[model samples]
Target: MFNLVVEMNTQKIRKDFPVLEKGIIYMDSACVSLKPQQVVKAMNCYYNEFPACAGRSMHKLGEKVTEEVSKARKIIAKFFNAKPNEIVFTKNTTESINLVANSLGLKKGDKVITTDKEHNSNLLPWQNLAKRGIIHEIIKSNEDNTFNMDKFKEKIKGAKLVSMVHTSNLDGVTIPAEEIIKIAHEHGALVLLDAAQSVPHKEINVKKLDVDFLACSGHKMLGPSGTGILYGKYHLLEKLEPFLIGGDTVIDTTYTTAEFEKPPEKFEAGLQNYAGIIGLAEAARYLMKIGRKNISKHETELNKKITNELLKIDGIKIIGPEDPELRSGIISFNYKDADPHEIALLLDSSADIMVRSGAHCVHSWFNAHNLKGSARVSLYIYNTEEECDKLIEEINKIVEL
Candidate 1:
């Protein structure tokens, strides 16, 4: 039954992405996934049919917009096994992380822990806080770039918060979040997962993980760009000072003061992205229907094929783990003495293959290791074996050159 479902989803997946019709092999899902027709249609419906503000107006179209936005929130909440009130909409993962960084109420001298491999979105906010007297510490990864739980255990002591990446976009390596979250809770530290890379490819239950907060971007999960979600425990969200205020965030305002609304409304300031929110919900719905396990499995198979073929070529260095299974859908590598951007451009010109190159927003890691950058090929459910073959072929040519 599972195989049948996977087969069915695979057959229908390409049709849903209109960009695939252009015969281009898209391998940059780690940066931004191609949106599906369902998500596009949902956003279009919001703009064309009931284009109005949500939660303010009482007219028919306004009410419809309000209802639809509420429904989107619920769908997104259910997708992560979170309560509707616990979910807060933000522009993207960057904004979501910044929201928590600014609002989490960490005092001077309070210790905060993070992994060394965090993206700039997860790294900069804490670094800024450190400049203001918050003791921000980083736990370096193992030699293979895997999470070092021992280092984490040592660093986590006296930490008020542990904000780390659930999956490293730099290498496609996922940390053991369940174990990390458990240890953090035992130490009385609140846990916030930078789940921008994990949530779209796997099933994540915020309650099960016992994560205090989680942040992810919709654009990486077949949703529209400029849409993202931040999920927190209801109590934690309630306690947080509002990151952005004014407009819909307040219930009543006086000349002296303004009374704020609760949880989600308080966090989502000003006018919301109504159409983007609707599209994001549809994207979540589409992923649920397709099954995240299926997507993960399909991506791993492609990665294995690519990794095996690439290994046959001399001086072709792959990042992260030696095993493709450990890297999820990503295969970030570099040819000997080759500029990653030049290789990316060559691949695009030669084979119509699109891949991401350079530091990938994790410049700290590259700088720490005294390296430049690597070419990354990130996959998704819509990718196929033929696409992997073309990638291998082009990469082989690039290496030969």
Candidate 2:
């Protein structure tokens, strides 16, 4: 069923974002969401007020920074139903996946399973493991581009890790991650979910899902850039190796050997994005304030409006699931014989409609399907129904032109 459960105040929410006032209809939130005033303020608070290093400094400013950072960690952990220690701040989703890939200690003969629809962040890490003699198995999607659980079940055998994207950026399809996690565990394989898209729109309980690890970016979820997190079960973290090490990662050090700190610390080497972390915490709070359930429903409602109108236009092909409920605020499509890039540029120049038109970092999927790229319109809370109308109007104009 469609998940529109909460009542939303779109006008109020739109006010928090200044860019909405600029007359530009931003439909590329899946690429990078515009930062709200609260997030920007939080970042500014760090730089202007208490700009200092965290964890290492013993001074007052340092202590304040460390305290704010710890609180941010707790807030992020709570959102995922994870322990505070389980959250390891990384640069972005790519680094988060790379952290798991590097630390998993995969041998030449070990198997890693993923899907054909994964963004390169999730796909390439596992592919790179092949050079270490680690085998990579990719399960093909169904004809409609939906994840084929049957194929997933067939290929998960003898796999050391099953890493998958929770949501497809290329098609806006949401995978049944809980079911996938259960099946992978039954087969004695660890599961990692690339939640870069899912975390922004819905509430995810890692504990309930029983996912071994997850990676997400803050930038896509109303937080600052250079901020993201890798979450691993505490016990499993103890087993995985640290991807990067130096500075605060170690508890004790000698000229030749060093004793590393615990999981989160060991993984976070050197200086971190202190401002980004604090800003991310504020963004998390902002999302919670509005409620993820409410955000999901609102975005879904908006997506359905656009989807319904788009389907009526002749020669316009909507990608992913036919059901608007399944698309999750992202609508990617191609017009008959029209280049997606050219369409995107025209839309921008004509009406200030910002959409993403490219392989979207899932070039493997595009290449496999023998297509070039599709124009994508991704929504967020700040978008209005009026904006959706304008988008449809522009699409019609483009098609006619």
Per-prediction TM-score, please? 0.98, 0.98
Off by over 4 Å in 2: 1-6
lDDT of 2 by residue, 159-226 (tens): 98999999888888889999999999999999999999999998999999999999999999999999
TM-score of 2: 0.98
- The parts of candidate 1 lying over 4 Å away from their true place are 1-8
| Candidate 1: residue pairs that collide | none
lDDT (tens digit, per residue) of candidate 1 on 1-401: 12223453564688899999999999999999999999999999998999999999999999999999999999999999999999999999999999999999898999999998999999999999999999999999999999999999998899999999998898999999999999999999999999999988989998899899999999999999999999999999999999888899999999999999998999999899999999999999999998888788888888899999999999988989979998999999988888999999999999999999999999999999877999999999888887889998888888777
Alpha-carbon RMSD, each predicted model: 1.6, 2.0
Residue-level error in angstroms, candidate 2, position 320: 1.1
lDDT of 2 at 155: 85
Query: Residue 244, candidate 1: how far off, in angstroms?
Result: 0.8
Give the CA lDDT, 0 to 100, for residue 145 in model 1: 91
